[model samples]
Every structure is written in structure tokens, then in C-alpha cells.
Target: MKKALILSTLALLISGQVAAKTWVLTDTESNTEQGNWHISSHQLNIKSSPFSIEQTVLHGGKQEGSKLLVIKSQNGLTITLIPTRGMDILRVEGFGVRMGWDSPVKEVVNPAYMNLESRNGLGWLEGFNEMMVRCGYEWTGHPGMADGQLYTLHGKAGNTPASKVEVSVSDSAPYTITVRGLLKESTFKKADLQTQTELQYVPGSSQFSIHDVLTNKGDYDHDYQIIYHSNFGQPILEEGAQFLAPIAQISPFNDYAKKGLSTWQTYAGPTKGFDEMVFNIAPLSGANHQTLAAVVNKAGNKGAAIHFNTTQLPVLTLWKNTDTLKQGYVTGIEPGTSYAYPVSIEREQKRVKQLAPGQSAHFDLTYQLLHSASDVNQIKQDIATIQGDKKVEEISTPMAKE
Candidate 1:
């Protein structure tokens, strides 16, 4: 009986049916799965799936002291997550394609070294190379002064380090890996907020997902905003690439954004001194209030899509910066609670969300990769279905409020 039991255990191990594993890389109160955050560097060699995940601390450049978690799957997926920057994704690579832009900023900038108030409130651009990054727990619009207070470019959520990070794997099939990061924003007399961001991946799939829960812990009600700045460039975003979305209402952000209104959904290769343009879009939702936005390459054989629910994120902003490669060429398909406008404007427009004391809100998004023409076409069809029978309202200029 003992010999048979030993053989059964060996068979389970060989088939990759071992028990689940959990690791706490920075939990402050837990002891069993906790790690010493004070330590400069360490490795957590997680190997329960068909792939691997490694944890290490960077030591050079603005990214110094940043904690980078790299995941590699047998399905050719590579994801880099930075816990030091509110669990923002650094880059994603798979199927001979990359999911990030070529920014002038070469290395990742540690949040501790970033000054969000510098350069006349444009300091947030210093550490803006991530493929996906959160924009706020308070504000995410342009820098301005309101109610005798100065608001910086974007809020502090993306620049705040996570107080706790934990990794766990499912014991069931597919063996998904879940990485959770906790970020807190608080002050003595100001608002108190906490955001728990979870990034999950199936080792052998060409997709990943983000789940975020934000809670207001202040004594009174508080208004907040959030934006998921999902940027893309290079191979998947080129000269003739197209932006597909179920647009119910669309308007140019400013006079400059109207220059390319004729080909708003089309892209240019690269130009010298090409200024950026933005389009404020209200997306149409299908069943269950779900929507999809995509960018397919010129050849229509490769693409990427962002799947989100319009209930939580009611607006989408499309940003195009087809500048020269050296000057950083990219585009952003941003889903957010409000448009990138001043808090006062959004409030007047009734787009700002208010949370009662101790209330929480949830946001979810998924990133998918398409490697074939059929896959890309399927997304286009899905978007078209959402647009059925709805007349698109295209404004020739900015609204009177702007």
C-alpha cells in the first residue's frame, strides 16, 4: 500500500496536478506567506504551471529599487508587472508582437523618484511607458485649479507604491495566476481611498485581465475619477491601422484634433512635428452593457482589443500621436469614469461619480491579442453589432462647455 501511494504521488506531480501555491511578497501583517520588503532583492521561483514567474528588484536608472514581476508562458506570452507603480503593466509580448509604445523615456521610472508636480504639472509623462496604467483615485484630467486647490496633471494613484502584493495560483485546470496589489491614498484632513488591483493570466492563453476595487474611507462623501490608459504602438499600430469602436457620440477635443477628422479612425505612419489629437467618444454597449474597442494593423492580420463594461466606464477617449519614431509614436484607447476634463466641468456635465463614506466601486477590463485575419474580423463584426441602427452623432467642434 505504501509503494502504491508513492507511485500515485509521482504520477500527480508529472501531470502537473500538484497543490496550489500562494506567496505574499509584501504583506505587512501576514507571517506565513510574507516576505521582507526591506530586503533589496530576492526571487520567488513560482513553477506550478507550464510557464514561470520571477520576482526581482531593478538597480539602475530611474527604475532603481522598483519591483518587477516577469511572467513567461509556454504559449509565447510574456508579461511584466511593476508592483512599485500601483501594479501597472510594463510590457506584454507574444506571437512576435509587442503591446507597448516606443517612448522617449528609456527606462521605467520608479514612483518614489517621480515628481508629479514638476514641469508645470506635466511630470506624469516622465514615467509613462507602461502598456497599461491606472490614472486615478481622485482626479485624472488636465491640470487646473479649482476651489482654491491645485490639481496636478493626473492623480497620485499610478505613482503610489503598493503596500501589499500577493500571488496565488488556482489548483484547478488552466492554473491561472492572480497577482494582487494594494494602494492607499490618505491624508489627515483630506480624502482617504484604497484600491486593490488584481492582474490575472492563464499561462497558455493569449490574454489577461484586470480587476480593480476602489473604496472611499473618508468621513464624508467623496467624488473620484479613474482612467485606464491602455496604450499601443509599433507592429500592431501602423500607417493604415484602424480604430474600431461602437461610437454613439464623438467630438474633437480641440481645434488641433479636428485636423484629421476626415480620417479620424485611420492612422498615419509617422510625421515630423506631428502634434497629438484626442477624440472624446461615448461608446455603445451590447448585451449586459459590454463594449469592445480595437486597433487592427494595416494588413488586418494582427490586432489588440480592450473589453470593458460601459456601466462603470461610460466614456472613451482616443488619443493619436503618430509622431516620428524617435519622438515616440503611440495611441491610447482610454476607458474612464469621465472625460479628461477639469473636475468642475465633469461635475457640471453630471459625469463625475460620488461615493458615500465607506462605499466601494469596482472596475474590470480585459486585454486580448489577435493573430489572424479571422480573429481581427470577428472583433470588427462584434463592434458593428453594437452599432446597429444607432445614428452616430459627430460634432464638428467642441461643445459649448469646453
Candidate 2:
């Protein structure tokens, strides 16, 4: 009996059946999985399913930090972080999503930003596919005091002292994520302090975690921009893709400016012939914030879906292809930390959230991907089911701590 028990325990450890395995995926090219997917740690690894190739950056190389996972869908959709030099360029070669980076707009110059905070590298949530905050941008081009890339995510840091980020993958699912960070100081100034954002991987459910501790190390109080950049490209947004939002009017960044000027004006109809589409969403109404849908259809085969969250975020930014623009290559269904202005402008517009010396603010949002819908109403019903009647509380869980 003792021998049997010992052998059973040993078997469990070797087979990794009781717990997930943290296999460092590196140096592998794209390939399909007969059953399970592969993970490696070598510089540039590509994992290919029968239908798609998922490439990750072990080395962003020659350029600064382009460290992001690249996905190439079976329908010929591809995505990669643009090099630092192309910071302002949002591109779509085919049916793909290109997340662009713009230099951070200085708050001091604009009086509208008296009590605002500023950071380098796209403001708000411009880095990834989704912005997990109220109003924010994707990527900013500024380097931090330390060598790491500085970014702001959703949620509040408050009195916490430690923070961390983790990401995991399952044999069947695409990705899982979670984040935690410490709030060491009450006053955080973007220019003064240096910080390190670490990535943690563990054996458990195939989920990713990201966490940070934002501090008000600065002398005065300021409202910081909190956003998450969630970028989905290619196969995710194909030719027949559709997006939904609670929008009565669509506006440009600058309505009366040049055609390509970062304008914000009410959108009367579908946006056509433009580089990208960025819109300002209205305030939250009950459970509906906004929804962006995308669909790709070739012949009769169709893949469609919608993306959005609840009250935590109140704006939506959509990008599609016009006659002069590349249609299906990229479509950004972005949620943000603030509307399209500096933090100061947000404050003037009564859109900024204040953070005192010892005070903190908590923000929450969620995103769900859909597979099929009977029609527009059915699709709306599907979203209603996911965003049904639950509020996301900002608290610590086992998934977040790991």
C-alpha cells in the first residue's frame, strides 16, 4: 500500500496531469497541433495550428521593445507591433489589425491640464488590443528613467506594496491573463521615479496576469491616465466583420482640421476612405457601454464577433478600411481611459478622475469574443448574456496572486 501511494504521487508529478506545466516556449516555428500546442523560449518562436501561426517575440531586436505576441489567422490575417521608428504609423497589410503608437501629448503646454499626469509611450491603453480603462491611447514613444517600458493599466494600486504580471496558455484556448502591481508611494510623478514591470509565469490554469503598483511620488496631486491596449488583428477582423456600439453620434478628433488631422466629430454614417476611425462614446447607461463587432467571410465560410465591456469604460474607438485605406487588414475596437485629449483636457471636460496623495481610484472592464449569431438581435442577446448582471469587484484572488 505504501509503495502504491508513492508511485501514484510520482506519476502525477511526471505527467503534469494534476497541475499545468510552465514550459518555456522558445525557438520554434509555426506548426499545427495534432492534439496539444507547443511553447518555447528561443528568440523568435512561431506556433502554427492547422489553420494559423502564432508568433511571439523572444527578441524584438534592432528596435526598442516590440515584445508582443503575433497572430496570423488561417484567413491570411497577420499582426505585429510596429517598430519604434514607425511609432505614428498604424498599418494593415491584409485583413489584419495594426495598433499604432503616437507621441504623448504634453499636459503642461495645455492649460486644460493643470492637475494632470503625463507619461511617455502612448497614453492610456494604446499598447495592446484593448484599453482596460476609461480614456487612454495605445502606445507612447517616450523611454522611462529605467530601461523598461512604462505603461498604465486598469484597477487601482491604493495601499498595496507589491505588484506583478503573469500570462499562461492552455492546450485549446488562445490566451489567459492576470496582472497585479504594488502602490509603494501615494504620489507618483511620471518623470521622477524609475520602476520595473516584471512578467511572471506559473503552472496553473492557462491564464495571463498583469499587475502594477502606481504611486504618487510627485509633490502635487494629479489625475493619471489609466488604460489598457487590447489589439486584435487579421483572422479576428476579416472581410465580413461587424462592430456594435451604443452610439447616437460619431465624431472625429478634430472636426474642422485637415482630413487626416486627429479630429473628433459626430459620425453620421459608416466611415469610409480614411486611415483609421477614432470615436468618442457617450457616458454609461445602465449595463451598456459600447460594442465593436468584426466579421470575416470568404465564399460562405464566416467568422464573426463583437468586443466591449461595461461601465468601467465609456468610450469606443473603431478603425476600418476605406477605398483609399486597406479595408480588412485592421479594425480597432478600442476602449479607453479618457477621450482623445491630454489628462488636463479631460479634467477641463470633467472627464478626469482625481487621485489624491493617499487616495486611490478603482476601475474595471471586461471583453468577450463571440463565435456565431443568428442575426443582429441574436448577437446583441449574446452580449447581454455575457455582460448580464454582474459587477467586477477589484479584489485579490488566487489567480491574481500567482
Candidate 3:
């Protein structure tokens, strides 16, 4: 009986030690654990999942009074969005690498402080730095009067807050977290527009998807335009970084872009007094109407790529500004339904899309961070294949009437 009792005690002690051991799966490719771990125990068992979504409010500074949703995946991707800022995605991080530019304004400022004055008013540009700053439903450009009505810079979409914000997580394999926000832009007896925006992230992947639906809820036909002004900054947009796209044609929007046309694909270190340049590009499309563009850092072996539907968003704008290194140094890769020019110009060109009452349009875009050198190289090769045997055509900018 004594020997049997001692054997039972020994078995219990052995099991406890075995359960206390931690087991982790190391990623051979990256030589890291990548957060896949599990611990066994008698009292409880804990395991780490591939993805997580969290919501929190930012306090103090410019971010005061802002509710933010943070989505993280095991693949080292993290995205931050502000529901108060028209559900705009403010920041994207992957593997300790920031994929967006840092705005001068440290916090997300309240829209109450928006300055809409023409000559002196800055509108949303005052705090314009975001991973994705949505433009439109109305006008998006310099402040001007269209049809005797005043329009501010980039319109009011970014300033309009969202309602019915929801965050949902999937329980099945390949777990995904999705956040949805509904924004209404309207005025009594005037125009009414409802924009439904969603951000989705999947586990074990460095990509996030954005889906948006814009509807005209007014009685009269309404002009609608939108641009996803996605920006990339340092480390990704550094001295050795390059912009790669399957462009069929490139039109310079100003004399500055024309003068530097030879070096449009190359980037320069931030310089003082550098004028911002804009280019309108027609991207080569695939059979399914897919298009791709990327900004790659050769030195850092990192890159950021965008996959979008060219049928829905046919125009691509590249805005490069090194004007003020400390204050405003960024490269913007914008895909939109219309050019970033004034609404009047788009109207004259018959490019302004009118949404009939009760009609809606949908847009989809995906951003992927290339964490591995091989992944970056693969994208570069793809862009090369698309540009094969064809030279990039340079055309004059479409003139806007005075």
C-alpha cells in the first residue's frame, strides 16, 4: 500500500511539470515565434489565437474624445481607425514598421475646429495626415464656389462622424475581425448621402481590406466623387524607395511634374522648397479589372502594395511632396473614381458621376505589407511583366476652365 501511494504521488508531480512547460511554434522563414504559443496546465489551459480586435478611446491631446478600433493579426499587422473621423484609417503598422506618414498634428483633432475659409481656411488639411483620408460625396480640392455654392478643401466626408459602429470577430478557422461604420452626410431639404464603410483583417496575413458603399438618399440626382488618399512615409518612402505601378500612361498635372518627369519613379531625399508634383496615371488592367501599385524600400527589404479594382476606380493619382521635410514630406498613391482636380473640371469633362436618387456605388481596396524580401521581389517582377514592351506615355494635364 505504501509503494502504491508513492507511485501515485510521483505520477501527479510528473504531470504537473509536463503541463507547466510552454510550447511555441517558431516561424522558420522569419526566425521568430510570431505569437503562436500554447501552455498546458491542470488548472487551466491557455492558447494564443491568430488575430484580435480591440476598441478604446484616446484621451488628451488632439485625439481627445475619439473612439478608436485597433485590429491586430498574428502576421504582425496592426491597423487603427477612428469612428469619429468618418471611419478613417489613421495608422497601419507591421512588424514594428510604420506604413503611413506621420502628420504634423500629433492627434486626431476634433472637426469642430475645422477652418473652411477660402483664402485662409485650411479645412481638413489642417490635420490631414491619415493612412487613408477619404475625399468626397461632393467636392474634393481647393476651396471654391460651384454653382454659387461654397465648397471647402476635400469636402466634409472626413469631418462627418459615424454611427452604428460595430466590431465583430469570426469564430471559425482563418479567423477575421471586421469593423463597420455608417456615416451620413446631409443637409435639410438638400443633399443626403450615406456611406457604409468596413475594415476587415484576417489572421496569418499582412493584408487588410476596405469596402465602402456610397448611396444617394436625396430626391434629386447628386454628383459624387471619392478618392482614397493613401500616404506612405519614411522607412517605406525613404531615399532608396521606388514607386512601381503598371501604368499605361502618365499625365503631369503641373509644370513641376513635367520638368521632373524623367525621375518620377525615383525618390529624392527631403529637400527644402520642393514643390509638390501630381501625376494622373492610367493603370494597365488585368482580365478581372484588377490593378496594383506598390512603394518598395530596397534598402529596408520592405514594401507596401495596394490591390484595387480598376473597373470601380479607374483613375490613379500620385502626389509627391518633399516641400517641407519636417512638416510635409509624403508620397500619396491615390485611387479614385475621378481626378483630384476641382469638381468643375470633372463636370466639364463629363467625368462627374451622378447618382440617381436611391442609387448606390461600391468601392473595394486592399493593402498588403510585404514583410519578406521575396514577397517584395515578387511584386516588383509582377509590375515589370505588366509594363513589358510598352513605354510609359506622358500626356498633358486636362485643363480646367477659368
Candidate 4:
């Protein structure tokens, strides 16, 4: 009987059928089966075969007072999501390649400190250092007041806290893990905005997906603007980094961008006193309403790409700030429902979208990190074909409207 039992144990170990150990740490909320996790040395680990999801809360230093969710796949993809910070993605690394930039702000601050009244209320800029930050239901660009009310830079969505956060790991085929949260941006006697967000990571793939739903719970029509502020920094945004997109129309936001429009596809080493440039682009439609954009390093060995629905997000903004190598050197590939203009200007141009009471809009975006030469080459070929087709045009800048 002892020999039979030993053989059965070995078979279970070989098949990986042995139940995984789980650990959980919480202060107020009760843990559920979906939240089954293993905590060791203050790390929350949820194992599902080859993929594991780890949860860690910041205690001290710059990361102090923040809660982060780390997802790891057997294929070497690692993603960190911060639930306390509007559920923004903090970092993405795969195959020894760092895919996001580092912000000068060393510490994560509570969303309560997001001030739009200090120095033009650019406090949001300090915490803007992340892989992806969702901007807006009212305004998203410069700070301005409309109808006797003031709107801060980039709105308040990024600073709003999320509730009902849930994490789940699946053991089925094509194993997957998901982190879901709900962010509500509402005030008494003001507009009501709710955003439901979900981040999904699958094993054996270098790509993940973000699904969001924005709804207006007010009684009247309300202006709405949302942008996926996706930023990429070094080693992906180096001196020779290349930007690729199927741009059908491009418009320079300022004279500086107009002067360098011809070489906008290339990048230069950071220079002192470098003026930032902004370009608004309308992507060419693809099969099933999809659009593509990417940034690849000079060596073309590492890069990141995005696939989004042009029908949902009709505009893309490319922000280049190459001021100094040590600081203020980053690029943003943003997709939004409207241009990154002031709220008044957007209204004047009739570009702002309106959500009626009880109406909701859904946005879906997929991000992929390219770790192999083949993946990078594929994007290059797509860009080449887009340029060769010669279906692109240049539009007048917003200043021209003045």
C-alpha cells in the first residue's frame, strides 16, 4: 500500500495536478475563490499553470502607498498595473526588453493630491509617468474654464480612484488572467461619469488587451473626450527610434512641427531647449475597422505596437518632447475620440462628442511588444505599403484656424 501511494504521488507531481498553494492578505474586503492567492514574503501570487499573477502593495519610498498588480506569463511577458492610480499600466517588460519610460517623479502620490489649480494645476503632470493613462469625460488638454466652471489639465479621470477591484486566474485552455476595476468620476449637482476597465493577459502571447466602457449617468447631454495616453521611453525611444502609422491625414499643431513634418518619422538624440511638437493624424481604415501604430528602436530588434478601432477612436496624437536626455525626453502615442485641443476649441470645431443620459461608449485597445526581428519587420512592411499607396494628405493646423 505504501509503494502504491508513492507511485500515485509521483504521477500527480509529473502531471502538475498537485493543487497549488494560495495566500491572501487583505484589510477590509473578504477573499473569494477568484481571489485565491499565495502570499510569501509579502508578495501575492496566484498560480495557474505556466502563468502567475502577483499582487504587491507599496509601503515606503516613492512607490509607498500604492497597490500594484503584476502579471507574468510563461513566455516572459511582465505587466504591472496600479489600481490606486486610475488603474493605469505602470510597466511592461518582456524578453529582457523594457517597453515603457521612467518618469522623474520617484514616488507615487495619492490621487487626492492631483491639483489643477497649482501653477495652472499641472500637478497631474507629475503623476503622468506611466505606460497608459486614461484622460477625460469633459476635457483632456489645456486647463480652461467653460460656463463659469474650471477644468483642469487632462481632466480628473486619471486621478479618480477605482472601486470593486477584482482579480481572477483561469485554469482552462488558453489560460488567462484578468484585473477588473470600476472608476466613477461624479460630483453632487454635477456630471456623472463611470468607467469600467478590464486588463487581460494571456499566456504564450506578447500582447495584452484593455477594454473600457464610459457612460454618462446624468440627465442631460454632456460633452465627452477620452484619450489613451500611451507613452514609450528609452530604450525603445532612443536616437534612432522610428514611429509608424497608417496616417491618412496629418496636421501640425504648431510651427515647430510644420518645419519638421518631413522628418517626423525619425528621431534625434535629446537636445537642450528642444521645443515639443504635436501632430494630429487620422488613420487609414483597415479591414474590420482596425488601425495600426508602432514605435521601433533603431536596431529594429525591440518595439511596441497598438491595434485599435478607428471607428471608436477617430484621431491619433503624436507628442514628441525630446528636450533633454536626462529629463523631459519622452514620446506619447495617443488615440482619442477628439483632438487634443482646448475644450472651447473642440466645441467650436464641432469635434467634441456628446453622450446622452444613460448612454455608454465602449473602447477597445490591444497592445503588443515586439521582441523578435520578424515582428518588427512586419510593422515596417505595413508602414511601407501605407506610404507607397500615397493615400495620405496634410491638413491645416489649429493655428491656421486662427
* Candidate 1 lDDT over residue span 201-319, tens digit each: 77766677778999998989988999898889998989999999999998988888887777889999988889998889999998778888988899999888888889989899999
Clashes of 2: 86
Poorly placed runs, candidate 4 (over 4 Å): 1-49, 61-64, 383-388, 399-402
* Over 4 Å off, model 3: 1-50, 118-121, 396-402
Q: Per-residue lDDT for 258 in model 4? A: 86
C-alpha positional error of residue 12 in candidate 4 after TM-score superposition, expressed in Å: 31
Q: What lDDT does each candidate get?
A: 0.81, 0.31, 0.71, 0.73
lDDT of 2 by residue, 1-402 (tens): 112223323433343333332332221133311122323422222244222223232333222222233323343333221211111112222222232212222111111211222444333222322212122212121123223533323212211112221223323222221112222223333422212222222222111122223334445555555444343444444344445443434444433222422222122122354455444444223323434333333221223333434344555445443222233234445555555443334555665554555444433322222222333355455444443464422211111100
TM-score to native of every candidate shown = 0.90, 0.45, 0.84, 0.86
Q: For this target, which candidate reaches the highest TM-score against the unseen true structure?
A: 1
Per-residue lDDT of 187-213 in model 3, one digit per residue for the tens?
887789999887766545567777899
By TM-score, the better pick of 2 and 4 is 4
Question: Model 4, residue 377: what's the lDDT?
Answer: 86
lDDT of 4 by residue, 1-402 (tens): 122223323332332442333233232245322233432212333343366676766676545567777877666588888777888888899886777787776666567655756776566887777888888866687667677876777888777767657765443434455577778888887778888888766656677778788899889888889889898888888898889888888888867688767777888878788888888888875555766788888999888887788888988998888778667688889999877777777778777898999999988887878887888887777666555677768765544331
Kindly report which residue pairs in candidate 4 clash with one another: 23-37, 23-38, 62-107, 116-121
Query: Which has the higher TM-score value, candidate number 1 or candidate number 4?
Result: 1
